[model samples]
Target chain A: MAELFISISIWPWLAYTLAGLVQVTLIVTLVAVGALVFIWLERKVSGRIQDRLGPTRVGGRFGWLQTLADGLKLLTKEDLMPEGADEFLFRIAPYVSFCASLTAFLAIPFAGGSYPFVALHMNTAVFFVLAVLGLEVFGVILAGYSSASKWSLFGAMREAAQVVSYEVPLGMCAVVPVLLAGSMDLVVIGDRQTGTFWNWYLFHDPFTFITFWVYFTCATASVNRAPFDLAEAESELVAGFHTEYSGLRWSFFFMAEYGSMLAVSLLASILFLGGWNGPIPVASLLGLTFENGFWLGFAGNVLGTANLIGKGVAGVTVMMWVRWTLPRLRIDQVITTCLKYCVPIAASMFVGATLWQYAFPNGAIFPQSAAAYQVREPWNAKAEAKSAEAARVEKTASREPVATEFTSGRTAEAAPLSARTPDPAG
Target chain B: MEAPIYWPTFFFLLFSAIACAFAVAVVVTPNIVRMAFYLVLSLAATAGLFFLAGADFVGAMQLMIYVGGTLVLLVFGVMLTSQDRFISMKTSGFELGVAVTLGVCLFVVLAYCARSIPEWHGMKAKQVSAVPLEPTAAPLGMGLLGARVDGPDRSGYLLVFEIISVHLLVVLVGAAYLARARGKKNLLVE
Candidate 1:
């Protein structure tokens, strides 16, 4: 019954559209709700971090609904347009940024196997995410350029420059994880590290451990977060490219930022840490397989999803900590960090990992036996078929007593095998 | 003996339509920044087209290297070089006429050649369906690592992949060298 419910209709494309719409809705809602919750959390966290009580008057004892109230205020505020601003581009920029942020999730696999909770289950999902993430810069660029304000233009230009430069090291860092996994499918990569915590890419090797840090630096820079957020430098550009924005539109920019923050954090989680796999294999040991009863399987998946979200949240929390703690890097310094430091480190790590993989086909640091705890029969039909063929061939070649080769033709092989048997033996 | 119009042919048609449309838009648009923006959309669509054409590796390449890296750089150039003069290039009437004449002629010849192919015209629409646009990453990877033994039963892209990688490295270094501010900044690491 559940399989029938999950199955698509005959015309595949109708199913495609339905699935795409559902995934988009899911990601959008989650991101929107997440943004609301995160905004409040950030305020609360910063408040505690800076030794003050943040927003204690909106909804409850802790002002838990402050973000909601703030959102309402933003929605009610008047929309303004500065003189000389390119009207079309200005209006479109935020949506473009917001859309780019949302679209990356279309390719990201949340849970399940090959056909996962991903919107578009493209083989090049990892590539698609990086491409879409890079596109977020365009909206910033458009917002800055079309604003007709010098500060806005400056901010946009800085963002454009920073993001483009940062993508190099980011790509290099990303390749390390892909390299280790031996496949670009995020579902495959995530599933490979299934059994335990140590199976994560961060612990794949010493080089990967270093690569994770490099990846984080690039991610921070790419997202225009603190220490690399010269584009929105408060002192210089007067809130940078988004200076012209207000109310809901301004909130849209923040939503995009937070959305992207969650995304990159998730990327780090999947690439470095074992995605949907906890520190302990309690679920595994408890006999919770996908083949288990529906309720049991669902409970297992829910636990895994919670685990993935927790890892992602931890990554976001780390980003917030870094934001509050470290001072923003200068534009030159940020570029230097990427081009000189991150790039070289990522490149060397890539090379080191390559050599390591060759020298030790099996992972040296951790046990491969643990990696194999979750048995992944990689959907390799061809390999299985070939093996089956070889087995059949061996059976045919040998002096087999009763070789009923039923790999393909059961009737033909069975009839002949029975006929070949002597009457006495029968 | 008759040759068949394979899946790649249909993909070529679809991709060419999109790539040509967006490329023409880039050429037609006068505003430099708008031109850059249009170019981004075009290149991305082209990347999609590449994926459709069973060049999954190239499609990812188109996205990662082209749209993400090159086009972003192009947009930055648009932002930077977009200071005063030449914000929009208004071509002269004569130049426009000449350009249009050549473009039409080239397109006509190409279209004529495409139509002239009997083998290409022979296949049914269903027979010419592309190598499913969904989940092309694995075959592409196999092609790259030189082990396309199964799925597509096609040859790997090792030699070209290697060359493209090397080419990308060169392009990176060259672009950096060219774009880097002279003397005022830290140009050399060593």
Candidate 2:
């Protein structure tokens, strides 16, 4: 898009900056709208689970505008800070958390392939998302410490411990799909699972099936949802790290939490469930893949975006249901689950999955059962073969007496290896 | 036509400035918690530099391990030990002066050495533009698995990798031992 703008009369810098701004704006709007909808959904889900009416009168039936109303109320409320609080840390904590959550989305592809859907097309997007997601703990810890309240401090401590420990298993579980797919690129990972529902990584093998559950559990803990939300146990810590925050500042923390929950759910869908790809290959069957014309490809991507969003919403709704249904764990129990149970289970599954992949490289669980989907040969195979052929030629060239002709540094032999290697894409 | 403003260099400068400024802030800050926060900013900016330099894997590793993991641990330590009196410990004037002098000396020497390298000065725009920004994750993985496929000479890091794994295990056990609860008398004495 920037290149298109640059091809016109626009300045290159201006075009690039504008393109970035547009992407950032889109992602920010997505998070804001996602948070609003999820909040309403959570309230309705929780209310139903608890045998009570959620909200019905706010904006017509079902209180569709309840979150908006709440946002206005929060905006109007007075901002409060404790007398003994660290002023600087107290003010910046929420933004730090929110920024971390927002940044993680930069690497996440809403729809697969090299397109304008992702804000930043990172190669190691899985690791990048995991890294940025972990940074959210800093904001919680800072908020807890700067609150100058014992409850807040305790909550922050638990949150830090729980999030840090849970990251191990969460990362391990995520790596299962990365192992199944050759590349760490989330797009490739998602693309590999295309074709059918059975082709999803969740059904790739017994280990991966188990891994999906473990990943969900760890992801739930990592995002600090219920059953593992020792960080904000109301009965114990009042409101945990955000106890001292009020009004807009308080809402930012909630936004960060909901954003991360959605992000992880989206990640899970991409990793285990066929991301963007539905149970059935609707778009592909309709002949709307990228191989089709530009308009059809765009339509396919639109459909994919909807599919991914739907899966993410379903995942969040399930989280809300679990939050209302189960009791929160104690701090010790949380630690125990992470260390004793999750870590070991994830480790065994990782090993098992690796072995399973080794034994059944074609993803066949049973000899009689056909593989769900044919694995796409890696995109770089031809490039690698070409490079090897070039290397062999270069070796032969170097061995000949003509190699001395390159000593003056003006011959083709003096060119760097990079110059010799052909780019398949180019 | 006049060459367009190099955006990569612009971003590199921006990230480097943030990183250096925050690093100085970390050193200057008296409060341990604030120092930790500044350190996080510094390290994060450094990670941005890594990304700008096209070392995405290393950059992500730095963010995850250094900024996220280690700094979180540091903040946890600061919080645990942060009593009102202990929150802001004043450095002695002599110590501060000496540290600044040494730091400046080291900076000058390092900067001089960096500038002394001929090839490091700058790359031709043509050469820079010719380089591909391909993903380094596959080569990095292969290198760790003891196959250096990126380079013509295919040496690997399997030995170093194994040694690091064993070292991490030892550190984990040692840390657990060090943090283990002792009797009340021993705790009071410590």
Candidate 3:
């Protein structure tokens, strides 16, 4: 979109800014709409599980407008601040949490092809997502502390310990897929798992299969869902860190929670499940790959996006099911489960997967050939081409003598870096 | 007409300003919790600077380990040590004056050193803007695993990586020991 404006003689800065705004608007809409849908889905799923009709009256039989109604109610409610609360911290905590949750989405690719759809493309996207996700705990802790309530404090403390502990194993679990794919880029990881379900990292090896479960457990715990939701144990800590929050401010925390839940689920789907790739290569079979024209490539991407979202939503549904069905673990149990079970299992699986990869370099089940396993250099190729073009332009611009020779020298230096650093697999 | 705004430079200025402002806020905030919060904002903005400098991996690590992990530990410590009584500890005027003078001196020295670097200055705006956003993850991973993939002459970080891993293990053990709850018998033993 920015390129379009730039091509049409608009100022580069304005075009870029407008493009960025559009991108942010799209992402915010995705989160907000996803949250609304997930809330409604959760109620419906929970109701069905308990053999009850959830919200039948709101938006016809399914009550699709329930979340909308809830949002309106929340907006109208008095935004209450605790008497002894730190006003600034209390006001900003939810935004911090929401922003952290939202930032993780910037690195997440919804689809993969010649031009994958992502807000920002980071090479270390998995790590970036995990890191941003971890920042959400700060907001929780601040909310707990600033609320000046004992229950809130307890909830925050529990969250602090739980999230910090869970991250260790969660990280370890995530690395197993990175190990399998041999790249930290989530798009690359997702692309490597293309073709079929068997190609998914979860089914790649026995160790990875086990690692996926461990990843899910730690992911669930990391997101503070039951049975690991000791941070918000309603029976004991009222509403946990959010005990003092009311109305829209309270809803923001939930939005952050649901957003992170969806993000983690998406990450899980991308890492363990086939991501945008389904059980079968429907798009490829339909000749909708990038080799086709632009429209067909877009169609493929759309299909892929749908597939990825379906997997993510499925993961979220499972989480909702677990939340409804299982009993919340005690704080001690949560800690023990992470330390004793998840961490050890993840570590052992990591070791096992490493050894497994060493034994069968291609794969055990599918046994893809070396040629088939060749890492794609498309991103590098495009980057190199762009840098070369940029260097040529810089050279021409430098001939005018207004621009310094240092600029040309720097461009020349950058050209080699971009061109030569193709594949670091060796 | 005015010169076109360089977006990257504009963003760099924005991030740096936020980072510097929040760093000062961290020092100025009286409440310990508020100080920690400010420190987080400062560190996060610094991470943004790292990202702007095209060190995405380093930026993420800064966010994860420093802002996310270490600061959480600091906040936990603050919460455990003094919930209400020491929430806002007032520093002595003399100490504050000394700290300010020291900080000013350090900043001046750092700024002088930063400005002294020749390669850091006079880069072509076109060149800076044209640098491709390449994924540094692979080269970083390879370097960690004892392969100098980024450059032919450069050395790998294998030994340093191993040492860091060991150091992390030691730190973990130390933390576990320090945090271990004492029984009646252990108290007597102590």
Candidate 4:
């Protein structure tokens, strides 16, 4: 795209900048539009779960424009500032949260192929995404401190403790997929789970199956959803860190929250749920691949993008389901769940998965697709093969002298160093 | 035709400017919490500089461990102890002078050492642009696991990694012991 613009006489830098802006605009649109839809979905889901009609009067019978109405209301509302609040930090907090959450999308590939749909093609994308997501907590902490309210301070402190504790188990569970894929690159991890539903890391083994649930539990807590959302605990802390925020500023926190929810769900899908590849492999079955033609490849990429988004949305819907189904956990219970249960379970599963991989390099019960197994680094395999051949030669060499006799028949003994050395004068 | 912009250099200048400016902001800021925030920005910009230098793994590590983990704790501590009395400190003139002198001396040493690299001094733009930014995580992971993928086979950092792990374990145990409650015996009876 940059090259096309440059060819049309635009300056090279400007062309590149334009290309970047296009990608950024697309991602921003996804986040904003996704937020609009998700807020409506959340209401609809919550209402359906409670056996009631939700937002029936807004934009039709289904209230399709309910979120838009809410957004407009939020925009026009008076922006309030508490007398004691730190003006600067109070103002910047929501943006900080939103930006950190949005930055994480840069490394998340929405489609997997030679040309992946991602803003930044990072090798350590998993690490990068996780790191950036962690920064979102800073905004909450700043908001809480700046609010000068007891509830906000308490909310922030709980958030700090909860997030810090949850990250340990979360990272452990995440590493299981990385270990299985043998790469931190999200594309590689996703590509490793191509072909069939059974090929997904969630179904890789007993350990991975268990690891998936643990990962989801940790993910839910990490994202500060209901049941583990001690930070907000609406009944207790009022509105939590954003209690003092009003108007669009307050809405930014919700946008950040929903954006991160999508981000982590997408990450989970990529890590454990086969990513852009569907359960049925419809695209591949229809001969839609880069090998066929550019159009076919483009079609495959489109299918992949839809597959990934569907999986992400499904993951979010499941999170909403869990939120509505379960009673909220106490703060102590949340911490205990992370430290005592999730940490130990994730650790054991990690160890078990490692052992399973060692026992079955080509997979155990369910056979992996040939392409998946072959994606292991060729250099590493080559080095091992080379070492094995060298060992075989050494073993045969040691036995060859014993099996056959030479014409001279001198005993096989070490030659003196001086005798073996060639004369320098010669 | 206009000369093409060198993006890496442009980003390098942008990151360095933010990093240096924020580092100074951290020292000059009166509020402790604001100082912590400035420090976070400064360290994050330094991480950006690391990325520009083609050290992606180190840059991510810098963001995760330093800016995310350590600074979060620093800010938490500041928030916990955030009385107005502790928010700002008034430094004495003599102490400021002494600190500036020490800072300047350290800066001079660092500058001298950086300038001592002859290859860095003579490197041309073409030479700089020719180097590809290959992902170092795989090789770094291999090296940590006792394989020298980037060079001739030799001793790698596996032993060092083990030693550090054990050292960290000891520190964790020590911390746990120190932080344990004192009056915890016969809790059921109590």
Candidate 5:
């Protein structure tokens, strides 16, 4: 998009600014719309689970516009601040949370390949996303501290402990895919499993299969979702961190929650599931690739985007299902789940996966040597090969002239390291 | 026609301004919690500066380890230590003078080192843009694993990496031991 603006050659800085605005608008819209849809979906899902109807009168029989109606009400509602609350921190807390949650979407690619649909194409996208996502806790902490309520302080403390603990296992679980793909770039990881369903890292080995579940558990806990949402346990903490918040400000926290839920779900899909690649390579089968034509590539990317979003939504739905079905764990239980179960399980899986990779370097078993089962080399293969060539050229260029007999003898094989050093006379 | 605005310089100035302003705020603020918040913003702006300087990995690490992790822990510690409202710690004039002297000396040394490098002097826009975006992750990984991919003539930092990691592990173990409950004294003796 920036390239398009630059090509026009009209106020280049303005073009860059406009391009940035467009990207920000797109990501913010996605987060807002996602929050709306997910809130409605959550209510509906919970209603079904509890054997009741939710928001039947808001928009229609199905109440499709329930979230929108709720949003409107929130906007019109009074914005109140506690007399003891720190005015500045209290006012900015929700925006901080929302911004951190939204910024994570920048590095996440919605599609893969030569033309990936990412706002910011980062080499270390997985790490960047996780890092930014962790910043969301600041908002909660600030909100809690500034609110001057004991309950809010307790909630913030619980959150600080929980998030800090969960990050350990969460990072370990995330690294398994990075190890398998030999790259931290999400596009590279996604491109590796381009062929079929079995190519998904979740099914690559028994360890990773177990790791996926562990990752999900840690991810769930890290995002503060039930059955691990001790930070905002309503029955005990009375709305927890955001107790003093109301109106649009309170809604920002909710949006941040759903935004992070969607972000982690998307990351999980890209890491463990086939990412933009479908169970069956529908785009490939239909010959819709960049190699064919521009339109074909566009179609392929569109399809890939749908595939990724579908997988992410599926993950979110599963989270919702779990949230509705299971009861929230106590604070101690939540910590134990992270440290005792998730951490140990993730660590062992890391070791097992490393060993599995060594034993079966091809990333397949039972049907080894089959051309179809071979993992595709990452997109950086060409660059690496070029670098290797450059290294070889450098080595040859630096070689010193030796005695005639020695040179003749060593011509068949590569010269020793010492002899390769450049002489004063070339 | 000349471009109206240079984007990189604009962003660099913006980030540096924010970092400097927030850092001042951190020192000036009387409220401890508000001071912590200012420190967070300052550190975050410094991370932005890192990103602008083409150190993406370092920027992300700064955000993760310093701004996100360490500062959160700092806030948690502050909260635990002082639960009173509007708590502030006042420093003596001697302490402030000492700190200012040390900071100035350190700044002078850093400025001298930066000035010693010929390449650090005025660079043209063309020179800046001529350098293509290089992926630092692969070479960084190789360097850590005792292989110098950037320049094969140089030795890798694998030993240093291992030593630092082990040092960190020892520190973590020591911290855990110190923080552990005293009720398990009998078990420890056993």
Candidate 6:
């Protein structure tokens, strides 16, 4: 580790590489930290809603250290296994949940303009995030089923049904923004919304305006938040899926829950709201050009990072308030709400957005659309034209033309191999 | 999109171990709930295999629909049917003996075919080329939308995509219908 750090210190490429690793480590840390904050926040929110003071002693004012204390206590407790439980499945389930939750962070872009700020930068990031998020239910199911308790099994069943039912509308709502952006890339979606608050897709078109609410409802359900948290409905299920789980294992599930809540919120900010894009175009106005402006871009990125985190925190706070203020829905009611209401609404909004995008291809419904926020350096028309010329040369040199593997062999690039393969003409 | 063989080799080995072990446990475990649990693990690991083979869509589909959806439904079925923790339906020792012998024979034949195939074993020590990792969303989205706008133009996988969409809708309806309790009879009648 020391030698590796030394090399990173010496070489600029190594510094960049180290920076990339730090970005990933930082996201994981943020999720861990966010989980701590949200759990505390949940308690406080629930407390105020229920007419009580929650966690006032730990870490001064707001009980900021309360989560850490709870975590330590959980760690010290005995790891229990119930009779008739599948040992391997029981042991592995929580890790699976945590893994799925953390993996979704890979595709989320915290800042719009920069290198290594984003974890995955997948072209299909929105889909990828949604897809991975769906996997978290398996762990919950496993935990409940393997617990050998009726309560646990019941909780798992409710969650399974809820997640599956909600995914239809959740997917529909997610696609509305994708349609408006003309790309599935989350960064592009965020950048497209980079001028004023009104530029956010929530105000883009009438359909998008409506789509935001549908998305929020579906997202809340997807994360098993209030009005839809029938999965872990404590009053009904007697502690639900984790009824048999004590100590560290139980905490893992909550951490996973908080992590997912934050993830969905971050996704919301990126898709419906302006992600890292603040209400003002500060970075662009300050002249953070791509070339010969690395430090300025870096500083802008740091500011955006702070902004994104602030937005994410604000979203989690809103969700907490909703959870506390609203009553939990029955499992049937939860599924009914998602399918009967959220699904149809999201579908209608999607169709409306598609028509709107079709009609107004480049029409700026808000100021952000024309804010001149940073675009990706490569993949522009000039570069596209150059690559087109290169393709022409390749076409003449071959009897049967190939798919033109120009950037494919170049290996390390921000974009995926699939992106470069598609001819402009096609 | 050649994954460094390190990934596939490690993944294939892990997948084979988990899948084989879980499959064996499924047969050996007396309790029905235990069998169901083993089956979920086995299928979940197979989803990982799908991911390793670069079928991200299929992997997610398996997780979201099969393991996450179907398996959860199956677990519910097991819970609903079971009156006891270990719900064992016994098969005779003679039946087990015969099945094991036959299974071993089939495995040998399968292993021979897999090991002997030139294409399968051709890249014994091949350098895993890093796949130019772009966001597969657009092409995948386009492919699903009946457009062959990217990749090796074999006219897109829109048919498969649409087929799955219809299939999932049907599956949801059929499974709900099948799993629903009749007014006169319980759903899990066993």
The global C-alpha lDDT for each of the candidates, from Candidate 1 onward, is 0.75, 0.83, 0.85, 0.83, 0.83, 0.75
Q: Interface RMSD for each candidate model?
A: 13.7, 9.0, 7.4, 11.0, 7.5, 7.8
Per-residue error (Å), model 6, residue A134: 1.9
Q: Judging by lDDT against the true structure, name the best candidate.
A: 3
**Per-model TM against the reference:** 0.83, 0.90, 0.89, 0.89, 0.88, 0.80
Query: What lDDT tens digits, residue by residue, belong to model 2 across residues B1-190?
Result: 9967788898899999999999999889888888888899989999999988889999999999998888888878777676682289899999999999999999999999999999898898889989976777766764675644455444566666777899999999999999877879768978
| Least accurate 10 contiguous residues by lDDT in model 3 chain A | A398-407
lDDT of 1 by residue, A278-299 (tens): 7786666786656666666666
DockQ of each: 0.27, 0.39, 0.35, 0.34, 0.37, 0.25
- Candidate 6: residue A399 Cα off by (Å): 36
Q: By DockQ, is 3 or 6 better?
A: 3
Q: What docking class should model 6 receive?
A: acceptable
Per-residue lDDT tens digits for candidate 5, residues B28-58, read 7788889989999999999999888888888
Q: Candidate 2 — which residues are off by over 4 angstroms?
A: A7-9, A114-116, A366-426, B1-3, B184-190
Predictions: Cα RMSD each: 10.0, 7.6, 8.1, 8.1, 6.9, 7.5
Predicted complex 3: CAPRI docking category: acceptable
Best by TM-score: 2
lDDT of 6 by residue, A1-426 (tens): 224466756654465567668866887799889888888888998899899999999999989899999999989999999977878778888988998899889889888754526766666678778877987887888888778788988898888778878888989989888766656677878877877788788888888888888888888889888878888888999888889999998888888999998999999999987988787867767876354477888788788888888888888888889988888877778878877888888888888888776676554564334433322222232334556664454344222111222232112232433453434356
**Interface RMSD (Å) of model 3?**
7.4
Rank ordering of all candidates by DockQ, starting from the highest: 2, 5, 3, 4, 1, 6
Looking at model 3, the pairs that clash are: none
Which sections of candidate 5 miss by over 4 Å?
A: A366-426, B1-4, B92-119, B183-190
Better of 2 and 4 by lDDT: 2
Task: Provide backbone clash counts, one per model.
Answer: 0, 0, 0, 0, 0, 7
- Considering the true interface contacts (CA pairs under 8 Å between chains A and B), give the fraction that model 4 also has: 0.26
Off by over 4 Å in 3: A369-373, A376-426, B83-86, B116-119, B129-133, B185-190
Return whichever of 1 and 2 wins on TM-score. 2
Report the Cα lDDT for residue B101, model 4: 92
